[model samples]
Target: MGTGLRDRRHGRKDGGGADGRNDGSIDARDLLTDEELGLIRMEEIPGKLEEIKRALEEKVGLGVSFDLVFRVMEFGTKRTAFFYANGFAKDTVLTDIIVRLTHLDREQLVPDTLSSLLNKYVSHIQVETEDDFDKAVQFALMGSTVLFVENSGAALVIDSKSFPVRSIEEPDLERVVRGSRDGFVETLMTNVTLVRRRIRDPRLKLEIMRVGKRTKTDVCIGYISDIADPRLVESLRDKISKVNIDGIPLGDKQLEEAIISKGWNPYPSVRYSERPDVVSSHMLEGHVIVFADTSPSVMILPTTFFHLVQHVEEYRQAPFVGSYLRWVRFLGIMTSLFLLPLWFLLVQNPELKPAGLEFLGPQKQGELPLLIQFLLVEVGVDLMRMAAVHTPSPLSIAMGLVAAILVGDIAVKTGLFINEVIMYMAIAAVGMFATPSYELGLANRLVRMALLILVAAFKIPGLVLGVTVWLVALSVTRSYNTPYMWPFIPFHAKALFSILVRRPILANKFRPSITNPIDKTRQPVE
Candidate 1:
């Protein structure tokens, strides 16, 4: 909460001002609370070993003990202690560190000597001193080992944070036939390393920071230093750093909401990918990536509507095949959005129907109005979807059977829904499932229902007005200042073509201009 670093001088009371001056009087408006202030102050180590022990016992619940590992080591006449979380710190690494520390000779062990021990003993690659006890405690909680010497004011922090994580496997959501099976895991370091493995260039930077006051959750911002726009990176960093929250338990989803701030907007502003290759591709195109700890999915920032609709499978196929696949997907997405509504419109105005298309309307109208039937079926479909999600894997097939046979047959036979409504709704649901982005699919579903209601109530004019409003909303929507409906709304021929048809890798010689990448040329001409 404090804006700047805490002064490390001895007995400088008045909570050393943010400007590093000993103001001698604590300001009432300082952001840090009294507890945080007390914990951060380490001008002097507690006079007795019992005092330090008592503080640790009270604050971190060391006495009551769960995962906290506390050990005191004696080297000749001097005594030192090490603290770390059991599950977070690797046993082998912690044992190696402790074994190395125990070998320290009496001559090397001087009273109140922190720097000498750090240089001579600690063999770990990541070791640093923390003047603040609060920060040291935080590091310990995050799985880093904290070393406390008998009389030293500073605590040595060893980075040994390893979390329980699943092995990298192909992401279920973004599966590809010919791509790498290695996907991101829940571990932050592992996820970052996955992206690093793909983009080996030194210019690719992954800046790490912590959010959440209590959780201190790690968040990484990745970008290509040469290609990515500096302003965009800095702006994203600024927005993330300013997030004031207790925790982000849902990880990327929560962070997305905090940053984009698009209230009540159904469309997703950022694209999410669990596949390292996909994230790598986006970063090369100058998009900034956000990786949150405990989340397998990383967010690709400043995304357009086209980005959400795209799938990794397209690139895996031949250019012509990919383009064909892309167009098919686009058709599916459009059908998901408009099929039901258009059918309703045609049914409402049978005069507009073509000569052979009279079979589109229901044979026998149900007891409920056509609009009511459509709404009820929509709600029923959503309920079935939710039920499927909650159902156990073993029972899922049985659940599907119940939904397909029992629900549909009973509804149609009882005159609650017509056969035409069931058939069309099922087709629409198939299209929705075909959509690449689940969030976008849901948004489309909502839009479809809205369009259906409008057409049912106010007829043809309502359908036109609703579509116009939808387009206007998308046109006005911005993702980190990048136009949401780029290429389509702004009329970029090349980009729009790229969206409509998957171009060969050799043909994509330039990065997207919308990102304002510093190096525009992805590849030089032969």
Candidate 2:
């Protein structure tokens, strides 16, 4: 039998309140640090046990169990016994332990044996003290059973946790036509296993870290041991270890900023792709991968400017077709960015046109400069985009239609702006959608306008200078100390074939050489 007794609250009113009150009534300011406070204990063992139970009930507002006592039976042995009426498990291991100790006697019991027995039978371990009541309650609530024992100032923990969980499925964002369909889920352990299953080499390493002060997000860095450069891995580990935040709401983005060399640049130094195949491809290339606990997107380091322009679809198909598609992508990028601006400027700026091309559109009736016309058209297109993004998905299409056709048609006909201006802006707007990632497309759309402003202010000379400076800055940037513009500035012959014109996978015999990868080959064994 146990008697629940409340211990006297002896700390100063100004001290750290057990229930989070700090009204300053108790002069607890200098009594002891929490480290020292956790070591204090009362001389009376049973009384202390009762006090702990009472405190737990008061603090957590839950049923406290302490009735069963330590039993000494006929055979020179001892056991702590409790009567559980929950009908949890009749043949369970815990039930079996309770039933087997019937003939034990007190003579067999010793301090060392008791410690060993508890450790051998218990499923969980937790250190407990009067000061750590809150933490103990948290563990108990998480499906751990807590035990308060007399004479022993600690609590016995039993793991009996069960929770509903979903089975893993192929990633929705990264569907493939002919590869393993398995993908990472929201679970951390499962994600690690997915990667490990693909790379069975003993040298493959998965380094884990806990970030997010509140979310406590689990992040894993993976690389091949014999294949990954040690210095690069160490540098990556150092960066991830330094991130301290309340919570990383966007897990992939959080890691990107941590490892990104050009954090301020609009061009993404780190590429995030959902497909494990893409990640594995990057890993083999000596690029480091950062897997966030929550987001399915894996951040691949040392990603170059050209990688964003290429697609996984190219590698899935034939070599000649892939090269043709890569060239098409280059053209698409040009169309997406400069098409509208050039179209608008050529038709509107009479000064830019050679004599015969002046017949392109209505002779300029307005006094507004070409720059002002572009700015106005850009603003109109932006308003339409903003409305589309914020509107409901079904309604977005309607909003887009209205903006593109209704308002735009009216604006042109009434001469608020030239029809050519609307046509040019519309082309640029469509071109922005050519990139795979929505975020990257949005970035290019923005940079194109800045490029437009330069061209409008100083024509082709200004455009050339802006593009040159941008490329120069990119060449200097590094991701995890690996060059951002890989295979381009370093000028790898094979990489140029793969990047600018993606060849057949068979022809792509060598991995990206600019990343200074530990291993330089990714050829599949025949």
In TM-score terms, which candidate is top? 1
| TM, every model | 0.91, 0.70
How many clashing pairs in candidate 1? Answer: 0
What is residue 336's positional error in candidate 1, in angstroms?
0.7
* Model 2 regions lying over 4 Å from their true place: 1-185, 259-263, 344-370, 376-389, 524-526
Supply the global lDDT for candidate 1: 0.81
Q: Please, what are the lDDT tens digits per residue for candidate 1 over residues 75-168?
A: 6567778888888887788788778777777777665468877787878766777667666777788778888877677778887777899888
Error of 1 at 517 (Å): 0.7
lDDT string, candidate 2, 387-458, tens digits: 876999888878878886888777666666776666666666666665665566767777777877877777
Colliding residue pairs in candidate 1: none
Q: What's the CA error at residue 426 for candidate 1, in Å?
A: 1.0
Candidate of highest lDDT: 1
lDDT of each: 0.81, 0.58
